[model samples]
Target: MAHHFTAYEVEELLPELKASLGLRRFIDEEGNEVQKVPLGPEPLMRMYITMVRARILDEWLLRLQRVGKVALHAPNVGQEAAAAGSAMALREEDWLFPSYRELAAYIARGMNEEEILDRAMANIDDPLRGSEFVVYGHRKYNIVPAPVPVGSQVPLAVGAAMAAKILGHSVVTMAIFGDGATSRADFHAGLNFAGVFRAPVVFVIQNNAWAISMPSRRQTAAKTFALKGVAYGVPGVRVDGNDVIAVYTTASEAVERARAGEGPTLLEAVTYRLGPHTTADDPDRYRPREEAKAMEKFDPIRRLGKYLKARGIISEKEEREIWSEWGERIERIVKRCYEKPPLPPSVVLENVYSEPTWNLEEQMRELEESLEVMKELGIGVE
Candidate 1:
C-alpha cells in the first residue's frame, strides 16, 4: 500500500516533542485580538514607555558626549525591541549578561533612572567608580554588571548557566551581544561549551547591521548569524528583531526550554542600530543616511503603538500623554546628570581589585599625592 505524506501527515505521524515551541499573540496592529490571549494593559503601556525613555536617553547622552560631559556613549536607539522584548520575557530570577549597548535592557530590568544617569555622568556615587559605567548592575534585579570587552560576556554567561545547573536552580542566563561580536572567537567558544554541557543559557545576537564602521555583510559571509549555532549542535533562529512580539515569543520559548533542561538556544535578531556606533564614531562616514531612513519605517515603538491603538488599549490622546510624560522625565534626569559633580580622584584607585594589594595601595597613595600637587598648582581635577 502507498501512503501520501503531506506536511500535515508528517506532523501527525511524528511523536510530540518534549519542547513545546510556538508563538503567542494577544492583539494585532489593527486593534484586534486575533488569538484572544489575555494580557494586562499596564505591561503593554510600560513597554512603550520604556522604549520611549531609551530613545530619549540615547539622544541626551549623545548631546552630553558632544559637550564632553561623558567620556563615551553607545546608543541602542533602533534596537530597543531586541533589548526590551527579551528582558520582558524573562522571569525575575533569571540572570542577564549584557554587552555595552544594552541601555534599554538595563532600564527595562528595573534599573533606577537616577542611578543610571549618575553612573553615566561618572558621579561620585557611581557604583562602578567611573572606570566602568555603561553596564549598570542591580543585584536585586538579577542583572550582572555588563563587561566592556566585546564577546567576553559570552563565556561569563555560560559559566553562570553552569553554576545554576550545579546549584539546581531553574534560573537561565541570557547573554546579549551584537552581530559584530559573533565573529569573535569568544562567541564560538562560549556557544560550543554551552551546547556540549547543555547549559541553561540563551545567546541573543542583536544584528544591528554594523559593527562600528563595518557593515555585517563585510563581517561574515554566513547567510545568517543564527545558522552559526548549528555547527555547535544547538537550535538557531532568526526573527524580525523590530517585531517585539516575535522577539518576546522566541526568547520566551528559549528560556522555557533551557529551564526544562533542553539546553541553550541562539537567537539572531535582525535589527538595525539607527545611530552611530558610539558618540566618538561618525556613522555617516561609513553608513548611508538613506539606509537608516528606510529602516525607520520598522521602528519597534511605532509598531507597538499601532498594536495598542488597534486593540483599543490606548487612544491617540493617551499615547501623546505617555510620550510627553516620558519626555519630561528624561529631560529632568538629563539635567540632574549634568548637575551632579564628577567622580572624586580617590575613586580612580578604588575597586581596582576585590582587596587592594600592597602594589595597588602604593599606586593609590601616589595618585593621591599627585592630585594634591595638582591642587596646589591651581589645577582642578574634578
Candidate 2:
C-alpha cells in the first residue's frame, strides 16, 4: 500500500468528530408526530406484529427462567425496534449473523416461536442436540449459529460476504451485536477485513448501552460506536435504534450499497435494554433509578404504536387483538414445552453424522440392547 494519504482517508484522522446524527425518530414517545411514518399500514403493522411477539415471548422466557422451566435467557425487552427494523431491511436472500439477545431479529427473520421455545427448553425435539444456545440459526434462513463468545460471530459474517462476492451473488450479510461487542477482538479483525476488501456486509451495533454491567461510557472513548468504523474506511451512521423507520432506512441503504458491490457500512442504533443482561443477572444493582425512569418514555413499541395510530394505520382495538392473539399462542407453546422432555440420549449419537459411523452404530445398538435388558429386569432407564 502507498504511504500517500488521500483527502477522504484524512477525514478519519481529524481529532474532533461530530457526535451522533442525533436520535432519528419518527414519533416521540407521547404519541406525537416527529416525522412522517415511513411505511403504510400493512408494512408498519408487520413490524408492529413482530415487536409484540418478541416482547411477549421475551416476558414469558424470563418467567420460565424464574420458575426453572428453562435454565437461562437473554431478554430483549426494550430493543425490539433495533432488531426488527434492521432485520426487515434485508431481502430473503440475504444472510444474518446475530448475537444472543437479537431474538427479536431472529423472530423477524421468520424463526417460529415453537422452535424458539424448543431451543430454550433444550428438549428432545430441538435440532442440533439442543447444544445450540438460545442464539439460533437455520441454513434455510441463511442464519449461522451464534457462537456464544461475544463478538466472535463478526468474522463469519465477513467471510460470508467475501464468499458472496467471489461467487458473484448479490447478497449482503448483516452482523448484529451489542454495544460491548465493539470493544472485542473479532469486532476489530472482522470490520478491518471487511473494510479492506469492501465486502457487502452491514455491521448493526445494537447500542442498547450495557454489556452486562458495563455502561457505554466504560466501553469506549469515542462519542459514537459508528465512528469506530470510519477508521477502517467503512461508512458510519448513527441512528435512533428505537425508531423503526430510522433503523430500516439506514439499514436498507447499507444493504443496497453492499448488493451494488460497494463495501461494508457500520450502524450504531442508539437504544436501551430495559431488562437484565440475561435472566441470570440482576440489573437493579448497576442501573440508576433516574436513567431507567427517563428511558421509559422512549420505549420502542409505544413510540411506534403512536406513529401507527396517528397515521390511521392501526387502532387501539386492533393492537389489543394482536396482543390477545400472541398471548394465546405463547400459552399453547408454554404448555407444550412443559410436556416435552430433553433430547433423548440416542439423538446425540445420531446427530453427529448424517449416517452414524460404524463404531457409533455398534455403540448405539449395544446401548439399546442394554436398555431393553435393564427394562425387562425391572431396572429404571434413568
CA-lDDT, candidates in order = 0.81, 0.85
Q: Candidate 2 lDDT, tens digit per residue, 1-382?
A: 7598889767765532342444566666666767775567777888888999999999898888888877789998899999999999999999999998887888888988887888787787665467765677777788787888889999999999999999999999999999898889999999999999999999999999889899987889987888888778787888889888788877888899999988898989999988889887887898886787788888888888877777787788887888999999988988897789878757656667777889998999998898899989999875
Q: What digit string (tens of lDDT, one per residue) describes model 1 on residues 27-105?
A: 4334345554345677777778888888888888778878887778899988998898888778989999988888888
Using Cα atoms with residue i matched to residue i, what is each candidate's TM-score against the true structure? 0.89, 0.89
Which candidate leads in lDDT?
2
**Where does candidate 2 stray beyond 4 Å?**
1-21, 349-382
lDDT of 2: 0.85
Report the error of model 2 at residue 317, Å. Answer: 1.7
